[model samples]
Target: MTLDPPSTVSTTSRRGTATAATRVLGVLTIVMIGWLGVFGLLLSPADRDQGDAVRIMYVHVPSVWLAYLAFIVTALASAVHLFGKSHSMQADRVAGASAEIGVVFMAVTLVTGMLWGRITWGVYWQWDARLTTTALLFISYIGYLAVRGLEGSRSQRARRSAIVGLLAVLEVPLVHWSVRLWRSLHQEATVLGTDLDVSLDGLMLFSLFVGVVAFTLLFLWLLLHRSRVLTMIDLSAETGLDAALAQRRAEGGVTA
Candidate 1:
């Protein structure tokens, strides 16, 4: 059966997912992105070594960081859905939302990294440990999202995807540590390295920090809206199914 349009859905669903707080969050995300563009793209000083090529790191670093954070959130939400006392569908929704966002950011990380690599290393692609593991990480989450799209009851789909999510997330640590674990062309962490010493220039560091904060805010905003959208979609489908079943029973002269 086809799902009803949002306009035709029940009053509770009609209220939609937006709120004053979400509106404020959306506004804040926009403002932070604008600030990041100024500082990260324009104002930040170019690296003496990498020159203007280094500016891309402001976006690339934050994208990978947020991708990791999003996948971690997905795993946590999936765990809550599977093992928590309530086993709430809300957790499943959050897991799906976070996974989708993680995949998008992962794609961003790969594209930006390839561009930067071409500029610095004279190649758009490499078989380096970090790059190879990162490509695998991206493909794994794509599979996770595909699993979520499989046909089943909500709980069944959630359980299947949850298991995959937990398994898929194990790859994150491998991707993060690949540089150190193997002979890779990828550079080790700068700001978040083992040494704890910051190697970037003062203004560049601040701009990178802003990029992180801005992307974090954007992720939160997107996650909130996406999860609510998933909730409404499920609710609408269940409502439509119930209505169809009721009509079929009426036509068959059956009583509940």
Candidate 2:
């Protein structure tokens, strides 16, 4: 028995699942945001050290985590495009969407981080290790987007962007390790290893937990929507090209 072409199989599967996946992501986004708003705004306890200012973490930390998650998606999609010849086009399109969304989230993370830092660290900017690496990560993607936006043939642009995507991913690991590798004012990871402080009360922890869930669902929803839009744009361009070619052929036939 012959196997279906990899592109045919991949496209078929993605099309079949796209609507359902989008719906699920949308519903989950609503639930997550609702919970986050309720808990983060009204329930989480004030920081004893920073007072209410510490509440920014609910937004800042989650945004940073989601930014990393988005970039990781971009990198994985780019890798698939570069190395998996069979599904290169599909992978590149997916990577494009992921990178676009990743950039948005990265922007949010940087803004929120700066706001939090100003209130807590007593400054709006710092050359701290984590901040610097995060800034570099943001710049790398900005460069990627610039390259992507430049005029080029579709395949040529895709290949070039894929390379950039892969290279930019190097910043992700650096961003994560920056706090550990250098002396920085940024706080270390809290949820992963440390014991929870009981003094803050259950409502506060619960609110933050809800915020994380909400932001994650929101990210998924946004990613799916962005991917769909990119795919539609690609399809529209292909259709326009085909129409132009058909018109030329008709004119030539008439002249003959």
Which candidate tops TM-score? Answer: 1
Instruction: Give candidates' CA RMSD values in order.
Output: 3.9, 5.3
Tens-place lDDT digits, model 2, residues 130-214: 9999999999998988888879898888889988999999888888877777888998766642344344457766776777788
Model 2, residue 46: what's the lDDT?
80
- Model 2 TM-score (2 dp): 0.85
Q: List the residue pairs that clash in candidate 2.
A: none
TM-score of each: 0.93, 0.85
Q: Write the per-residue lDDT of candidate 1 for residues 151-210, one digit (tens) a residue.
A: 998889999999999999999999998887898899988898778999889999999999
Error of 2 at 33 (Å): 0.6
Task: List the lowest-lDDT window of 10 residues for candidate 1.
Answer: 1-10
Where's the lowest-lDDT run of ten residues in candidate 2?
A: 1-10
